[model samples]
Target: MPETLNVQTRDDFGKGAARRIRAEHQIPAVLYGHGMDPLHLTLPGHETALAARNSNALLELVLPGGDSHLALIKEIQRHPLRRTLTHLDLIAVRRGEKVQVDIPVILVGEPTAPAIAVVDAQTLTIEVDALKVPESIEVDVEEKEEGYQLFAGDVKLPAGAELVTEAELLVVAVQLPRVDAELEAAIEENEAAGAELGADAEDSEGESTEESADEE
Candidate 1:
């Protein structure tokens, strides 16, 4: 699900130091695991960004005093206006350890009919062995007909992963798309008619102004 990462400890904190760290292409983060004191660290910005591109990425951290730890991304903060990472929080995990994480649901295959695939849920939370979390959950809908509905229970789970989501959670459904298309066409036609009416009103006003000038 995730890749390995190596990080170093940071001695500084607060705004000014964070700005300097970001300027140096490093991300400020806090690492906590096994009930140990939180360690403030700075990670290589490019590597961290690449690792975080995946969902529920697992990280292998090499800390100070020659200590090494395993963890997973728990939270991330981004710049409000810029495309930079601001802060990160990581939770410690062990190999084969079970942890709860959200995995994205991916739609696979296509329906035979003109049915629109509706994704009722984008992500599902599950209890998975730390290293066993799937990058994504794939649902094959190939050759499926319209009016087919899929629920959370319908999703195939990988080994050692248990669904923490509610059974009633709707995963996806296939339905006809004609109704939406018809509504969009109607709206476009009405807009065109309104534009034509507005042009006619303007022309009439111009004609009246010309007649008044001629009489004068």
Candidate 2:
């Protein structure tokens, strides 16, 4: 679901103007798309920040003049030190239209014993309905054995969703746990050999002393 909120339109521009907007606890934004000129906007910081948590947040933007538009939060720039939003970008969209979005990919269930599921792709690109974007896509790995794999094209998409990623791209990799036990074993064997060498050296010295005494 999407969120609906009223926002103030901004006529002011430039660095100083942007700084002033931030001082008021608002985020300066530019709305683009649908072949129209970009509109400058000032959004409430608290509400915008909350909505920005969702990567594909659909915004129902209401302007001061009572005009409204359906937009997607395209991009967000954050302040490095404060970790707050400095600017935002919005792209206008219409209902029933297809929009390209990168949705999070999640791995569910455990693979068979000695095998682990590793997600190679964090987010997957797909074209889905603008109004009905899915939260995330899940990949199942239960009872999967080593060498199991899931490619981007093989993933099941939501209804009406089309994969935009390369078909041959690997999405998940299931393989046996990588371990190195030979090195440790080799070190232990070397230590045992060293101990035997030391014992033999000590015994040789004792025998030499005994031979010297016997000659004396």
Candidate 3:
């Protein structure tokens, strides 16, 4: 679980103002929801970046009136080349309130045999208390035999957690190797073809040389 990040609101907006905010080591962010007006804000750039490094980060917004609000980091815009945070959107939340969010999926364990784990679903959307949202779910695939397909229903969630995703959805599948055998066969065929071509070239050169010698 990640700790709450502290943020302060900003009054400025737009492209040029956002650029200046970044140069001042603060990130531009917007907070909306609860049927209220959107509040523009600026967060400490370094702390914001570090907190977002982890998935499903919980943020604490400290408003000007000494009031603190809990929020979830919704969307983040970044510079394409520099990879710096350009803007962010935050959604306010209340404690013990269930919020819909997508948590990351982590695979664990190795499947026996040459099998591929096909992940049909990468994230699981669930309702959890705003203060207790999980960052990710760990899927144990260790020593699983081939042809073992794990579904969303098969995931073992942590305590106090509920699944909001459809149980029938395929989360992962350990199937028989799909490409190794074919790739090896193709390589062998290519090598055989090259050998035959080399032999043919040598034979052609020998015949030409013999013909020239006889003419001489």
Candidate 4:
């Protein structure tokens, strides 16, 4: 089900207007798609933030005049320092229609012991029904051994969903963690230097004892 947010149309423009809107705890947004004129609007900051937690969240925008539109979040701009939502660009969508979206790829379960699972691609592009879009796609890596690989085409998708990403793209790989060669060499060099220092200290002590005995 799509999360519904009551939105208000806005005529204000420019940076000053945007700042004022945000000051009032609202987010400025623009909605455009399907041959319709772009609509400038303001959304509730708190509700929108919660709804946007899901990258591919579908939203139902209800206008004050009792009109509603289904929209997909196309772009979100955030403050670089504060990480607050600065602006949003939404695209209108319809139910039963196919839309292309980048869905997150999640790995489930652990790989075989001593092996680590590495993700090559974080998300995959797919075409699926607008209303039936999934939050994320899961790839099972349970008991996968070292050298095991998973490609884009190997990922399972919901019914009616088609992959838009290249089939040969690497999604996940299982491998054994190995130490860097330079680090290993540095460790050996440090051990050798410490051993040489110990030998020199022992020789100095023996010479001091011989000199003391000669003086006595």
In terms of lDDT, the best-performing candidate is: 4
Top of the candidates by TM-score:
4
TM-score of candidate 2 versus the correct structure, residues matched by position: 0.79
Ranking by TM-score: 4, 3, 1, 2
Once model 1 is optimally superposed onto the true structure by TM-score, how far is the C-alpha of residue 209 displaced, in angstroms? 14
- Per-residue lDDT of model 2, residues 1-216, tens digit only: 679878999799999999999999999999999998999999998999999888789999999889999999889899999889999999999989999999999888999988888899999999999998887899999999999999999999999999999989999999876554667788899999999999999999999999999999
Candidate 1 lDDT tens digits, 1-216: 456567789888899999999999999999897888998988889999988877488888876567877878889899989857888899989876899999999998888767778788999999988987778999888877899999998798998789999988999988888788899999999999999999999999999999999999
**What lDDT does model 4 reach?**
0.95
**Backbone clash numbers for all candidates listed:** 0, 0, 5, 0
* Regions of candidate 2 where Cα sits further than 4 Å from its true position: 179-216
> What TM-score fits each model?
0.82, 0.79, 0.84, 0.86
Q: Candidate 1: deviation at residue 162, Å?
A: 0.5
Off by over 4 Å in 4: 179-186, 189-216
Query: Weakest 10 consecutive residues, lDDT, candidate 2?
Result: 176-185
Pairs in steric clash, model 2:
none
Q: Rank the candidates by lDDT, best first.
A: 4, 2, 1, 3
| Model 1 ranges off by over 4 Å | 182-185, 188-216
